[model samples]
Target chain A: MTDAPDRPADAETGTDLPAGPADSDAETDPRTDGGLPAMDGAVPTRDPGAFSQLATALGRPLVVGTVLVTVVFLILPVLATFAASFAHEWAGVLPTFVRDGEFLTLVNWRQALGLTQTDLGAQRGLGGFWTVFGVPIPVTIGFSMLLALGGVVINLLVGVPIAYAVTRYDFYGRGWLNTFAVLPVVPGIILGVAFLKTYSDLPSAVGLMIGYSLLKAPYMVLAVQSSFESMDLRQLEESARSLGASWPRTFLTVVVPNAKTGIVAGAIVCWTLAAAEFNFSYIVYSSGPKPFSLFLFENISNNPFLQAAAAISVYFAIVVVVTALLQAVGQRGFALGGVR
Target chain B: MSTLDEGPLVARLRTGTEALLSPTTETDRERRRIAALALPFVALAVFGAVVPLVVMFRISVAEEYLTATAGVQFDAWVTLLASILAFVPGVGSAVDADPVYGEVIWNSLWFGAVTTVASVALGIVIAHALEKYDLPGEGLLVTLISFPISLPGIVAAFMMIVWFGKTGLLTNVFVWLGGEASLFPAVTSNEVKLTGRPSGTTIAVFGLFLGYLYSMVPRATFLLRGAYAEVNTDAEAAARALGATPWQTFRYVTLPQIRPGIVGAVILTFRTALAIFGTVLVLKALSVVTFRFDQILKVGYDLPTASALAGLFFFFTVGFTFLSLRFTSAEVTG
Candidate 1:
C-alpha cells in the first residue's frame, strides 16, 4: 500500500527508458534503489503459492478464451445469417454463395423484399413497395419505421420531461416515480393481451405505436436521465432563470438542447427496437400491413432458410446503421438500455 | 377550521389541487412545476398501461369471452390455481387436474433461473476481461457484443438455428466428423430416437437454452460493465502489491465490490429470461408460460384463461423485482 506512490514513477521510468537516456539514468537510479527494495520485501521469495501459480498459468487463457468464444458464439451467426441471405443454397456445412457459376446472387434478397413473386405465396415477402414521388420504399419496412418513429416521438415527449423532473427535483415519491419511469411496467406480451379487449376498436397502427412507446419508454427515460445526471440541472436551471429566461424556455432551449445527444441516441435505439418488436406485434396484429418483426417471423417460420436469412438480414441492415449512428452520438451501441 | 366539515383528507386534497392550479409561493411553484412535468407520463401510464391492465383483469374474471364482460366469474382463477396445485406430486393426484400450467410455470422459473445464473456468470468474466485486460479492438468488441442486444428474440432463435439446426454449421461439422446424423442436435430433426437416450427433447431444449443465452449474455455483460466501471482500482493495486495473486485480488477485492452489481444483473436478467416469448415462439422447444399464453390465445382462443395467466405473471414479476430491489443493495442503471 505504501509503495503505491512508486508505482506510477516506475511506469514513467519504464516508458521514458528510450526517450532520454540521460534523464532515464537519474530516474532508474532512484527506481532501482528505492522501488526495488519495497517490491522485494512485498513479493514472496519462497515458492509461488498453489493458487497463485494456477492463476498465473491459466488465468489469462481462461478469461481470454471465454471472451473469444462468447464473441464468436454471439457474432458468427449474425455474419452467417447476413451472408446466407445472399447465397443460393445452404445444403451442406457452409452456405454456397455461388449460383449458376456466379459468385453471388440477389434472388433471395429480391424475393424477400417482395420484389419478385414466388410460389411461396404473396404473404411471404414484404408485400410490395409503397412508392413515394417516383421513389419506391419497401412497404413493411417503411410502415414499421414510421410506426416506430411515432413511438420515438411519444417517448421523447414523455421521457424527457419526466427524466428532468426526477433528476432535478426532490419531491414526495420521487424515487418511486423515477424507478417507474426508467423500469418498464409490463412486458410486451402482457401489454398485448391487455390491449386485446381494452382497445379492440383502436387502429392496429395506432395501438402498436402506443404500445411501442409504452414498452420502449424506459430506454428513452434512462438515456435522457443519464444525460441529465451528468449535468448539474439545478445549476443550469438557476443560471438560465437568473438570466431572465422563463422556466419553460430554460428547459426547452438550454436543458433539452444540452441533452440532444442522449435524446438522439435514445430515439435510434427505441426506433430499431420498436421496429423489431415481435411479441406484442405478433399477438395484436390481426389485419393491415405487417410490422417488420412479423415479416421476419413469417419468413423464419414459413419461408425457406435462405429467404428467411434474407428477411432477417434486412433487420440486420437497420440495426447496423442505427448502431453506427449511436456510435456517432457518443453511446456504445445499445449499452444504455439493452433490456427488451 | 373552516373546512373541518369536509374532513381533513378532503381538505388537504383540495388545498393540494389549489396549490397545483395556482401557486403564489416559490415552494408551491416548484411543486406545480414538478406536477406539470410529471403529468404527461402519468397520463400515458394511465391510458396505456394502467387502464389496459385493469381491463385485462376484468376480462380475466369476466363471465363471458369477447363480447361485453357481463357478470363476474371465478372459474378461470379457480382452474388456474387448481392446475398449479395439481403440479405438486401428492396434491396433483388429489386435485385431478392437468398439470400443464404448473409444468409450464415450473419450466419458466427453472429455465429462467438456470439461464440467469449461466449468463450472469459469463457476464462477470467478459466484463472483467474488458475492464482489466488490454484486449485489442475493445471498442469493436463492445460494439459487436452489444449488437445482439438490438436483435429481437426471434432473430436470436434464428441465430441458434443457424448454429444448431439440422443443416446448421455445427451439426454439419459433427456429421462431417463421422458422427451419426441421428445423434446430432438439429432443429429440423425431432424424430431420430436414439437407443437408451431421450435425444429429441434434450436437443431442442439445449438449442433453446443456447438461444436464451445468446440474448441474455450481452445484457448481463453490459449490466455488470456499469458496476465494473466503479470498482476502486487503487485498492486492487494495493492488494496486488501486498503479494496477492491475480485471482486472490479479484476474489477478495473486486468480487465484494461488484457483488451488488451481480445481484442487480441477476434480477434484471432473470426478468428478461422470464418475459422471453419470441424466442420460445420461434423455437417451440419448451412450453414455458409465455408460450402457453400463445397457445391459449391463438389455438383455442381462450381469452379468460390467457388473461388470468398474464395477470398472474405481471404481478409476480412486478412484485419480485420491486421487493428484491427494495430489500437488497442492487443498483440497476439499465
Candidate 2:
C-alpha cells in the first residue's frame, strides 16, 4: 500500500467502479446497469457526469492514500530496523543517504554480527556467545531452531493423542477436555509464573518446554482435530477394522497418514510460535540455554541501537520468512490458528 | 417415549446378565480399550493445566506473612474478598488497601475496553474494505494486512519503540522539525517541540491500542471474511438499486449479517488486550493486571499477593470465556 511515485494508472481499477456516470451511457456492459438510470435521475440537479467523475477521481486517491499510510505504519519498524543496521547515527523521519557523498557506515552490522567488539558496556558483551548446556554456541539461529523444534516435538507428542481422543471418541469428559484444549489462549507470562511457582524444582529448560508445549498444544489440536472432523472416521476406521487391523494399529497406520498434512502444519505453526515466544521465555529462562527472543531482549538496551536493531532484524527476518512459508503452506491445506 | 425410557435400561439389564454369565466379556474389554486410548490426553491435561491452576489457587490463598514470621498461613483469601468488595459502594474500605490493586484493576478494565472497541471497529472496516473492494493484488494486500498477527508481541513492542521511542525515527523527525520551527517563531509555538521522552499513560494506552489492533485485526478479518462471504449480496444490490447510499446499505443490510463476527472479534480482542503482557512491559506501563502480576510475582517475590491477582485475572478470563460460549451457543440455537 506504500505510495509508489510510479503508481500505474491501472492501480485505481480496484476502487473505481465501471458504474460511474460518464461510463454509464455506454450501457452495453452488463455491470453498468444501475449507473445510467441513477445518473438520469440526478442530471436535473447537477451535471452528473462531471460530478461522478470528480467523485471517482477523489475517492480512488483517497483510498489509495489511506492504504499507503497504513502500509507505512505496518512496516515502518522493520524498515527502520533494517536501515539502522547500516545507519551511522540515524536521526530523522528516514535514514540519510549519501553521507559526505559516500555510503554510511557498516559499523553497526559488524558490531551486531560479532565480527568486532565495540566499546559497549562490560555487562553487554559485544555479540558474544549464547550458551546451551554449558557450551557456548555462536549462532543464535541454531539454538532458536532447536528450542522451537523442541516445542514442536513436545506439542506433537501431547497434541496428537488429544486430537485423536477428542475427534475419535464420545468420551465422558469430552466437552470439558475440548474446553481445556484452549488453555493456550491464556497469556504465556501467566503460564510462565504458574510453571515457575509450581515447578520450582524442575530445570528451567523443562519448565520452558512444558510451558511452550502447553501454550502450543491447542493450535496443534485444533489443526489436527479440524482435519479429523472433516474426515469420515467411521468409514476409514470401520474399513480398517474390517480388514483385520487392530484399533491402535488402524489409528496409527490409517488415521495418522490421513492427517499428515495437519500434523506438519501444526508442527510448523508450533515451531514458529515457540520461536517468537518471549514473555514466557523471559520469565522461565535464566542465564543458561537462552531462546533467541531472550537473546535479543537482553541486548536491547545495553548494546548500541544499531547493533540491537541488527539482532532484532535477524529475528524479524526469521519470523517473516517462517510466517511467509506458513502462509504458503496454509494456502494448500490447514488454516493457521491465531496466537498472540 | 416408551422405547426411549426402556431401551437403555433393557440394554443395561442384558449387559448385566451377560457380564454375570461371562466375567470378562468382549464389550468390557472394548470399553476398557477405548478408555485407555483417551487416558494419555486426560493425564497430560491434568498434569499440565489442572495441577498448575490448582497450585496457583493454593499459593494465592496461602499467607505470605504471619504476625511475626513468614508462614504458610490463611487469611489472604479473606483479604482478597475484602479488596474486591471494597470496590462496591456500600463497602467502606479494604483492610489491606494496597493502591496497586485499585490502579491495576481500573487500568486493566479501562485500557482493555478501549483497545477492544478500537480494534473491533477498525477490524470491521478493514474486513469490509478488503472484501468489498476488487483491490488489485488482493491476495498480497490481504497477506500484508494480516501479517501482524504472526508477529510476536515482543516484536510489536520493539516496533513501537522503533517508531515512537526516544531516538526513534518519528521522534527524530519531530525534533528536527522543531529546530526548523524556531526560525519561524510567528508560526511555531513553544509547545511544538518534541521532548523525545518515554510516553505517559495516554500515549502508552494508544500504543497498546495499536498493538492490540495489530494482533486482533487479522483474526477478526479472517473470521469476518467468512461471515462476509456468507452474506447475501443480492440484498446489497437491492438496496443499491433502491437508491440507498452505500453507507446506509452497509449499516442496515450488511452489519446485521456480520454481527456474530463482530461479537466474536470483540470478545477475542478484549481477552487478548486484557491479558497482554509484552507490549505493556516494553512500553514500561505496569498499570494493567497481567504486567502487575508478573512484576509482583517475579520481581517483588510476593507469592501470596501476586497469586491473588492471578486468581482474580484467571476468574476474569473464565467469566469472559463463559460469556463468549454463551454468545456462540445463543447464536447457534436461536
Candidate 3:
C-alpha cells in the first residue's frame, strides 16, 4: 500500500511522521527548495491523499495475504496427505495418530507399497514385485521408473542436439524450429490416441517411451536452451575447433559438458513427470506391468482414503527427492520449463 | 556445362544432396551440421507425432477401425457434427441427436477460460510480491509453489479430496461450525450433482474448480515470474520516488511492461487447462471433453467418434496457441 512503501522508507531514513511537529518541520525544510519548488504543494504532509492512504493501508496486505494463502493452499494438502498416510484414522477434522490406544501406525504405508497383505478385496496394493539381487522392487514402480528413464534417454538424444542447434547456429526456419522444440506440439492424450491406432502392435513400453520423449522433449529443450543461452556457445565451439577438436567432438565434449547441470535437471524433471503421467498411460496401457501412475489411479479411485493418501505419498516422496536433486543441479524446482 | 544437361530443380536437388553428403565449403558444412543436429528431433516428430496423427485422422473416417481400417466413411464425422449442432440452442430441435459431445466441449472451453483467468490474476499478485518485495525464505516459497507443477492432475484431484471431501479438513471444519454437513463443498461421491445451489445440492464442481486452480496457479505464477525477473525495477523505483502509491506504480508502470507476459501466461495456462484430463477423470464432477474421450474409447469402443473429437480439440488448441503467439506481442520465455 502507499503507506507500505513509506513505512520502510521511514524506517531506513530514521524519520517518523507524528513524532513531533519540530522533527516533521526539519524533515520537510530541505525538500521545499532542494529539487522541485513547483512540487512544494505536493510534498509530504501529516495527512496524505485519501487514495494514497487507502492504497497504503490495503495493498501490501492484499498482495502478501494472497501469497501466504496461496502457499498454504498449495502446500497444506501435501503435508496433510503425507501425515495422513502415516496416521491411524482420518474420519474427523484431523487425521488421528492413535488407534485402539496405540499412537501412529505404518499399516497404510505398508499396505500402499505392497509390503503387507491386506484383506480388502479388489483394492490391492502394488500388485506384483520383482526381485533384483535379493531385493524386491514393486513391479509397477520399477517398470514406470525404467519406462520414464527410457523416455529421458531419448529426450537427451533428441532434445540436447536441437537445443544446441537453435542456440549455437543460425539457419532458415530457426525460429519455427525453436518454437516447435520448446513448445509441446501435441498433448499426451491425443498422442496416446494416435499411438493406439498407428502402432497397435507395438509393445507398450516402446510406445510409451516414444510418446514420452515427444511429449516431454520440450522441457529438455527449454532447460538446456537456458543453460546454452547463458554461455558463449559460439565462442566455446570456435575455441574447441581452433584447438584441433572436430565439430562433433566439440559438441559432445565441450558443449555438452558445459550444459551438464541443465541436462541433468531436465532429465530428472522429465523422468519424474513421465513416471507419474496418468492421462496417456491411462489411455494407452493395454497389458503388461502397470505404470506407477495407473497404480496411483487405481488406488485413488478404488481404495480407501488413507490407502490413496499413502499411494500418493509414495509419489510425493519421489518428487521431493527429485526436487532436491534438481536444486543440487542448480535449477529452481522445474522453473526452466514454461509448461510441464 | 554439366548444369545445362539437367533442369534447375534437379540440379539444385543434386547439389543440395551432394553438399549434405560431402560438403566442400564452410557454408555447406555448417548446413550439414545444422541438419545433423536437427535430424533426431525431426525424425521423432515425424514418426511419433505426424505419422500417428495422420493415422488417427484416417481412423476417424474408417469403416471399421478395430478389425481393420478397410474402407473410408463419413458416418463418424456426420454423427459428431450433428451432435455438436444438436447442442446449439437454436439448432437443437432440428438436429435430433444427443448433445453430449457439444455439452462436453462447451464445458471444457468455459472451464478452461475461467480457470486461466483466475490463475493468471493470482499469478500476477504472487509474481509481483516475489519480485518486488523482500520476502523471507524466497527460495523455499518458490520451491513449495513449484512443487505442484511437478504433480500430475490426478494427484491434484486427490489433493482436493484431501481438503474438501466428506471427511476432508475444510468440510469437517465447516460441519463443526454449526453448519449443515450437506451445505459444504464435499466431494463425497460421483452422484453429487455438479449444478445448483449448495444448500441441498453437492458442490463437487466447486471442489473440482479448486483442483484446477491447485495445478494451474503454480504454472501461471512460474510463467509470469519469468517475465517479472526481467521487469525494469528502476522505473518502478522512480515512480515510487515521484509520490506514486504502490498500486498506482503497478497500475501505471508495471502492468504495461508485463502485458506481453500476462498474455503469454494466459495462452499457455489455458492450454494447460484444456489438456487437463486426469483431474476431471478422477473428480468426475463435470463431463469435460477429455473425459468424454475416455468414455468413448473405453466404455463404448467408439474409436471414430473419439478420434473425430480429439482431432477437433487438437486443431483448436494448436491453432489457437500458434496464432495467438504469432499475432500478439506475447513474449514466451522458457
Candidate 4:
C-alpha cells in the first residue's frame, strides 16, 4: 500500500537484488561505452524550486507503474471471471454489470467441475453435457497434467545421462548432440502433427508422449547441459575417485547434488508446460483427453458472462498460484536456482 | 569376391578398432556407452524438426490441395511443386477470398507493430527507470513484470476478454457512465452490433495482441534490459552532456547497441503472429467468408487457405529468422 510521496500507484513488494555499481563498471568502461561511467547509477534530481524533495521521493510509482500495468493487463480479467462466476445474473451495456448483488457462488464451480453438463436451454445453450473426460473439469486437463509431469520425469531421467556423458568425457557426436539440444524454437507443432499423423493408429497417449518429447527432451538436455557446464565436476569425481569410491558411489554422493538446481528447474518447466500445454496436445489427440487448454477454452462463449467456457482467466489464476507455491518451495529449500 | 586385402593396413585397422572398444577407465567405458545412446536423441531431433519441416515445405508445394476431401489435396500440391514460380498467385487467391484477410493482415501487422513498439518502448523505459527510480519495490516490480513469460498466449486472451469485454468490469465502469455505446461496445449477445460491425475479428486481434504483449514484453525487457544494464552511465552522461535530448540519447546510444535484441524481438513477434490462429479463432470465432477481422485465427483454421498461409508464413519465418541471425551476428561480431 505504500505510495511514492506525490504519486498515485499500485502497491508492490518486489524481490530481485538491486542493481549495483560494480555491474555498472563493466558497461560504463571506456572500452564499452566510450570511457563514460555507466549511468545506470544516475538519479534524476528535481528542480531547485518548490516540491523538489517531494518529486524525488516518488520513485516507487515511476518504477512500480510498469509492473502494475503488466498486472492490470494480466490479472484483472481473471479476477473479473471469478466475479462473473459469483454474480447470479449478468445484464449490461458497456460498463453494465450483474443486476443481482451475488458476486460469488459455487454454481459456476458446481456446473463446471461436475462430470455431466446440464442443458439449461438458453441459460446453458450448449451441446450435450455428458462429460468428455469423465469429469466436468474435462479429462484433458488431467491428461495434460499427467503428460507434462510425465515429460518432466522422463526428460530429467534422459537428460542427466546425456549431460554427464558430455561433461565427463568426449564423444564423436557430442558437438552435434549439443547443437541439436539447444536449437531455438522452430514451429514445433508442425513436427508434432507429423509424428501424430504418422502414428495416429497407436494409443494416442503414447503418441502424445513421443510428440511432446520431441520438444521437451531437447529443452531438458540443454538445461542440464548448461548446469553441467558451470559445474566443477573434477571436485566431485576426484573426491569420490580419490576416496576409493566406485563410479556409481561417486556420482551418487557428489555429482548429483551439484546438478540438483538445474534439474529441478527443468522439471518445473516441464511440468508447468505439460499442465499448461496446448498445441502438441491438440494436434496429437484431436479432441480427446490430452490438452489442459481444452478446459481453458470451454469458457470463450458468445455469452461472455458464461466465462466457465473461456476459463483461460482461470488458467492465469492457476499460473499465479503455481508460481507462488514454487516461490514458497524455493525459499524453503534455499534454492540455488528456482524455476523462472 | 576375393577373401580380402591382406596387408599391414588390415592389422593397423584392427588395432584401431581394439583401441576404440577397450577403454582404460570405468568413466571412459560409461562415456562410450552414453555417446552411443545419444545417437538416438540426435536422430529424433533430426527426424522431428529437419525432416517434418522439409516435408511440410514439400507438401505445401504439392498443388493437389488437401480439401474437405482429404485435408491435404494432390492437385494443389503438384501445382505448387511444378510452377516453383506459381506459389504466389496460388496462395494469394486463397487468402484474398476473405474481405477481412487484408484488413486482418493489416490489423495483425498493426497489432504486432503497435505491441512491438509499445513493449520495446516500455522495456527500454523500464530498464532506464530501474536505474533512475530505485524505489523500494523496484526489484520485485522488475521480476513481476518479467513473469508473464510462462503465461500462455491463449490464457492471456481469455483474461483480456473478461477484463475488456462489454460485461467486463472495465466495460461495467463505462456502463456506469450512462450506457456509452460509443466508448464501450456490446459484448454479451451476437444480437448486439459493435461499432456498427458485429464481427469479433478486430476485437479478437486486440485480445491476441494483449496476450502476446504480455508474453513478449517480458522477454524483450529481459534481453534489452540486460543489454542496457551493461551500458555505462558515463557514456549516457557523455551523450546527455553533448546536448542530446533524453529521447536522442536513447535513440542514438541505447538503440543501436540493443539492435540485436530488438531484431530478436521482431522475429519473435512475427513468429508468434504467424502462428496465432488459436487465440484469434477462439476469441472471435473468426470466419473466412466474412473476412472482416485480422483473420489471425482464420489464417490457419481453414485447411487449404491455412495450408497455403502456413507455407507463406514458414517462408517469412525462416527468412526473418535467418535475416535476424545474419544481422545480429554481423552486428555483434562486426
Docking class of 4: incorrect
Candidate 4 lDDT: 0.52
lDDT of candidate 1 over B166-198, digit per residue (tens): 677776666665445544455323232111123
Q: lDDT rank, highest first? A: 1, 3, 2, 4
Task: Estimate every model's Cα lDDT from 0 to 1.
Answer: 0.85, 0.65, 0.85, 0.52
**What TM-score goes with each of the models?**
0.90, 0.77, 0.89, 0.68
Residue-pair clashes, model 1: 0
lDDT of 3 by residue, A211-249 (tens): 888888998998888889999998999999999999999
Q: Candidates sorted by DockQ, descending order?
A: 3, 1, 2, 4
Candidate 3: what lDDT?
0.85
Q: Give the TM-score of candidate 3.
A: 0.89
What are the per-residue Cα lDDT tens digits for candidate 2 across B1-334? Answer: 5656678779898776666455496566555555565566566667766787777777766654322223465565666566655655455363445444666787788878887786666566666766777778777767676666656666777777676666665666556666754544453322322222344545555656666555666655555565676789999888656544455456667987877766766676677777677776766644677777667756767777766677777777878876776757312100
Clashes of each: 0, 0, 4, 44
- Interface root-mean-square deviation, each candidate: 3.8, 6.9, 2.8, 7.3
Q: Name the lDDT value of residue B264 in candidate 4.
A: 54
Off by over 4 Å in 2: A1-68, A96-106, A113-141, A168-173, A183-185, A332-340, B1-37, B63-72, B78-96, B173-200, B232-245, B327-334
Q: Which ten residues in a row have the lowest lDDT in candidate 2 chain B?
A: B188-197
Give the 10-residue window scoring lowest on summed lDDT in candidate 3 chain B: B192-201
Report residue A66 deviation for candidate 1 (angstroms): 0.4
